[model samples]
Every structure is written in C-alpha cells, then in structure tokens.
Target: MTELSNIPHALKGLNSVVVHPDFKFPDADVVLSVTGRCLYEKQLLVDTDIRSNHSESGGASTSDDDEDFHSQTSRDRRKEREEKNNPEKPSQATLFKVHKSVLRRASEFFADMFSIPQPSNQDTIDGLPIIYMHDDPIDIHNFINHIYNSDVLHYLPLRQSTFNMMSSIIRLSRKYLLLRLAPAAMFRIRSDWPTTLEEWDKNDLQVVAITRWNAQVRDGSQDGGSRLGPEDLLVEPCRVIRFARQENILEILPAAFYHLSRLSSLNDPHRPRSCIEGRKRAHGYWMGGGRYATRSVLTPADWDTLMIGKAEIRAWFVNFRQYGWQSIHATNCGADDPSSCVLSSQGGWKNYWDEVIGVQTRKILAQDGLDVMEVLQVLRHVVLYDENLCSGCRVQAGKIVGCARTEFWDCLPDFFRLKRPNPWGGIWMEGEPVDCFEQSI
Candidate 1:
C-alpha cells in the first residue's frame, strides 16, 4: 500500500514537472503512460483490454472512443431528410442545368429586345449553348457582348464579313468612335500605311510622297518663295486626285466610314439601331437611296429562318474547319523547313507534304508524333517568341541554318534516329542506321 502511494506520488511529480519547455504536462504524462502500457503489454506484464459494449440500440461502443454513435446516426438521418426536402441543393449537374436555362432565358430576352426571333434549332455543343442572331451588325454585337459577359458562349467563330459588318454598326453609333479611332490610328501607323504603300506605285502612293515632296520643295526653294518644283506640284491635293482617280477616294471613303461606324458602336448601349429591327429599318432607308450596300437586314421571322437553316450552318462549319486545317497545316509544313509548302507561303510545294508525311509516319510509328519535344517547342514559341524572335520563325530558322553542322543532328530526338547506326551490331537495343543496306538497297 505504501509502495502504491509512493508510485502515485512519483507519477504526480513527473506529470507536474515539464520534460521540455515545448512539451506540456497532461499531454506528456498521457504519452508516457501510453508508452509504458504498450511496453508492459508487449512484455505480457499487462494486457490491453479492448472491451466493446453492445448498446441497447444495437450499436457498438469501444473504450476510449469519444464519438457518440446515436448522435452521429441522428445527425446523418437529419442531413438525409434535409437533402431530400431541399430543392436547391448544390450539385454539378444541377448547376449545369441551371446555367443552360439561364442562357436560354437570356437569349430569348435579347432576341425580344432586338425584335428578332431566336433560332429554333438552338443547340448545345460540348456544354456551350449557342444563340444564333440575325446577321444585323448591331444586334450581333449586342448578342456577342451578352453571351460573352454571361459566360454562356465558350468559343465563338465569326465570319470576317460578319465581324466587319458589326464593327461598322458600332462605329456609326458614335459611342466608342474616339476610342475606336485611337486604336485605328495606331493600326494605320503600324500596318495599314505600310501595306497600302506597298500595294501602290509611285503615282498611286500620295500621302507620304506628297508630304515628303512638299518638304523637299520647301527646303529647296528660298524661305518665302511661291515657285514650286514638279514634285511640289504633285503635292497638291487636286494634282494627287488627278494622278489617281477621284472615284477611288469616293469608293474607299464610304467603306472606311462604314467600318469606322461599326467599330465605334461596339460597347455603346445608347447607340440607336444597335438592334435587329432598328438596323433593318436603318438599312431600308440607306438602300432606298440607291447607295451600294454590302448587307441588308431582315424581319425577325426571316432572320430566324436564315439562322436556323441547315445549309447555312453547314457552310459556316465547312469554312471554319477548312480555315482551321489550313492554318494548322501551314504552321506544321512551314516550320523548320522554309522550302516546305505552307498555305501562307508563296508557291512552293503544290500540296501539304507535312500532312502526307505525318499520315505515313503515324502508320509506320503506330503512335502520335507529338511528344515532349513538340509540346516544349510549342510552349517555347508561344511564350518566348515576342521577347526573343518578334513572334516569327525566321530567326529560329536562321539559327538552325547557322548551327547546321553540329547542332542539327543533336537537336533531333532519339526516336528520329531510329535508323541510325548501332556500333554493337544487331544485338543492340537501339535501331540500325537510316541508310543501312536493308533500307537503301
């Protein structure tokens, strides 16, 4: 009894004293007791009695198990009942279903707003809900914004003409004109001016030529002199018009204005005729005046009929697929080998050689050719192009050409050298040389 009392007193002292500053009292004592119990059990000096009690409710309870089985069971039952009763329970399928409904509603709302009937054949592709509107530029722009903002449309493929038409509508609306013009000025500086000049000859190229010629004429003559050189005479707007045709300006100005109008109306809600009926009415006035027009609007019913037409949709798909295939094949063929036939390149090979080779390679290799190197190259091109090579492959091709002697073969993957020589004879795991006797002769 005295020994037992001394043992308890010794345990209290051990529990009270901190083993380490980081270690707490109750936790350390509990750990030490558990360790001792485990050792005693291992030595057969003490047995760990894992007694389980079968409760009156047919539930089992174990020693040291703090969880109340009755309470857990009750809670689970309540949750099940709540889930069954609740109509708005969050679920993936439900969320998707709700999204689909919301998109449909939004489409209907916009169609009504524009006085255009929705496409009857409204369908979903790969979880993306599509709403086809009448090809009215304003209505189309609004619809694009609507779907884009709502996150209903995942991918949009618009015809170039359609995009241009919408842009013109936006520009004429006057809401985004200045902002649109700002970007247009930059674009003119970067691309349009250079391209236009390249297309024209000396007589046709007026703006830059006139400006330069005038400056030269001013510099060549005395400061206040009125007498001009032949170049200076050419600098006059009247002379420039006569050199070209006045009709060219008339033709170009309307088209430019049309596109500008479309661009300006893009984000402006206050812009009138930014809807199907409004655009159609506007077109009626414009067309009645005997002006050359690229597009004419239709009634809501007519628009819906057009949108739902199988042939039209099929044509769109065909064009889109062709364009995508051409773009991809162009990249693949033009890549590395500059001489290869790509659609973007000037006349080289008559057909896509890379695609032909790719098909044959697949038949031979029995696997996809796009591996880690191809993936890495794609990533490198996307990320490193602008920073390193102005987003053009010309510099990369040049580098390859410069490093052709040693780096060319080294750059190629092991699989590409399937026919390369194995010095260990036929016993080696690696393949034979590409120009081996069996392959060559």
Candidate 2:
C-alpha cells in the first residue's frame, strides 16, 4: 500500500484524504487511494517516430528531452498554484471512500483481497482500511460510478469523451476482474464499430448522410448551419484502433481498420484541424467532405496491417468485377430468349463497371474502391432496380452480392492478420473468459 504521504507527491500539497465528491459514501469502510497519473498524460507514443520501451502493463515509457521535462514541470507548477488557491476543485480528488461490500460484489479482485486476513499493522484513514491503487483517478471514479449507477455504460451519441470514459471503465474493470462490467463495456465498443456487414451498411449510410449534409451546408444549399459538424457526429477510427490495440480488444480491430482504410490517404491541405498538430502532432487524414479531419496515431505495424488489408479488399473487388459475376447463372428469365438475357446481363455488368462503378470509385476514393460494402450495395441496387435487366439476372446478382459481402466480412480478420475470438459481436456469457485476444499482439 502507498503511504498517505506519497499522495501529496501526485496531488501537490492537496490533503492526503481528499475524498471523491461523488464517491464519498457515508457508510464507507475503505479508502481507495488512486495514485496514478491522469489518463491523457500516460501517452502511448504520440509520435510514430519516437520509439520507446513498453511496460508489461501496456504503458509506453518515452524518454522526454530536457525541454519537454522543463515544460511539463512548469505546467505542473502552474496547476499546483491554481489548486492551492482553489483546493476544493473536483480535479484535486485522489481518494475514494467506497464500500467493501460493493467492491467484493463487483470484482473478484476485491473479493480475494478482502478474503485475506489483514496485517496487524495495516494503515487506516478515518478508521477504515486504505487500499492504494496505481490506476488513473478518473478511471477509478468512472469504475465506481458505473458500479453505483449502471447508466455509465450507455455509449450513445458516440463522442470521444464517451469512448474515453468507457475505455477507462473497461481497463479498470478488466484489471480488477469485474467480469460483467468488462464484457458489457466491450459490447458497447463493438456496437459502435460494426462487426457485421448489415451493421457496416447502417454505419456507412449514417456517414454518407452526414457527408452530404455537411457538403450542402458548406455550399449554401442547406439552411441549418448551426447543426453539429462531422467531428461532433462521427467517432474517429484511428483513436478506436489505438485503444483496441492497447487493451487487446481484437474483435473490434477489423471494423476499425476497415473504416480507417476508407479515409483519404493524403494529408489535410487546409490548416491544422486540431491544436495537437505541431512538434508531436499526429498524422492527418480526411474522409470525402473535407469539413472534418481525423488525426491518425497509428504505428508502423498498424499502418502495414491497414495497407495490406486495404489492398486485399481492393483486390477482392477487382477479382469480383472480372470473375465473380461470370459464375452467376441466370434462371427463369422473363425475356423471350433466356440465353440472350444472360448474355445481355453480362454486357450490362461490364457497362455498369465501366460507366457507373469505375467512375464513382475513382471520384470518391481517388483510386479503385477499397470500400467493398459501399460498392456491393451500389451494384446490388442497380441490378435490382434497373428496368432493362431481367428478373433472373437481378435475383442472381443479389445472391452473388450477398455471398460476396459475407465472404469479405469473413476475410476481414485474416486480411488484418487478426485472430478472431469465439462469441464475437456481443456481450460475453458468464464464465466465458473475456481476455480472448491473441497473446502475441
């Protein structure tokens, strides 16, 4: 257990027993002394160029230069001065007075910890046993808040802050063996990042709608300029990918990678989208509209996986264009000559690719389309609705497209070189170990 004196080191002269405002249980029997750095301060390599040794607990240790350290020290001193003047600020909290029963009920770690006989010389604060932890104070607060109020797990409205909170809960829950909370958190994450083709379509449609809306507003075609921007509406994929990799959340990796791959590879031509765009700036990429830019924090290995997976998706589309439709056998044609209809269907497919598909692909993605889901939807819609195409060819096209979509989704894990865990796409059942990510990642 960390001494109470050590609390001042992190809190900067703040009282050792500064209780969390929301977690100040009246009948509390334990004090959780959260002594970890703020979550954002624990950077996992801000720049891809700066390499550092990673700790076993998945934290990277960067060797900050003298100037960086000096700047950090100056900021710390400024914060300390501010806190000294306003000591009751919520950010000054480093202690949580929580119930042991709640902890034991929610976490196996706490249950085991309490089950053990306490030392005769155990330290106590306010006549309660003190349990020191090296987890972020905000994470501890979020974890306990979730325990007290289950509503913290609701990941609706998909904001970066929501994701960050959920991530903190997931990380701490997994650390302390909160079996139910951990899996539930994972479920929320998977829900946001589509794992199935149908879900992907829904997400893509939302993005498409937002992109069009933003475009219209920008061009003075739409009236609602006060509406939320794309950045406010959409969650960035690269950040999700980073958290997933850090926590070994393998199931969400395929969808995350796929989404990231869809963004334009070129850098933002306009001014920096964010303040974090200078010395330690992240790489920038954008989707179609250009109203919002995503700062990507991908490592070399992640980039390699993304590039390789994207290439595989593009190759699948190219191969499907040439050979996939050829195998479609048109049956029960309403045409006078069924053979002629089949021949015309093949010609229609060629013309569709040449005129519609190829042009759209180039215009949107600036290359051959890497988004298989989008292309598949377009192809199916044209085949089904075209007045000229026979019903027989339409049905065959639907089946072929459906099968191709499924095939592509199935290949996502392999395409990204990710090991898919059993019982993916939902909350894990009781006693089903949730640490199913491949050990080697």
Count of backbone collisions within predicted model 2: 0
Model 2 worst lDDT window (10 residues): 44-53
User: Each candidate: what lDDT?
Assistant: 0.27, 0.59
lDDT string, candidate 2, 1-441, tens digits: 223343334355533334443354556788888754422222211111112222233332332321232244326646656666775664533677788998998899999999999997676666777787877776776677667766535634455445655787788876799887888777777777766777767766766776666445545634422233323445667878888989887778888888777666453434444455521121222224432325458888988998888876676666666555354442334667865664355565566445644654555444532567777777768767756657766776666666666667756766666666663433444344432122101
TM-score, predicted candidate 2 vs. hidden true structure = 0.63
1-441: candidate 1 lDDT, tens digit per residue: 001112222234321211111111111111111111011111111111212222333332332222321133436545545556764553111001113332334444432433544454434322233332223322323332333233321221212222232233333323323333324323322221121222222323443354455555445556432323221222112121121122222222211221222221122212256577655544332222211212223335322332343223233223322232232222423355444423335532224223432332233222211122222233334423334223344343223222221221221212122222322123224443332211111
Error of 1 at 254 (Å): 6.6
Error of 1 at 25 (Å): 99
Q: Best lDDT goes to which candidate?
A: 2
Q: Which stretches of candidate 1 lie over 4 Å from their true place?
A: 1-248, 254-258, 261-322, 327-441
**Inter-residue clash pairs, candidate 2:** none
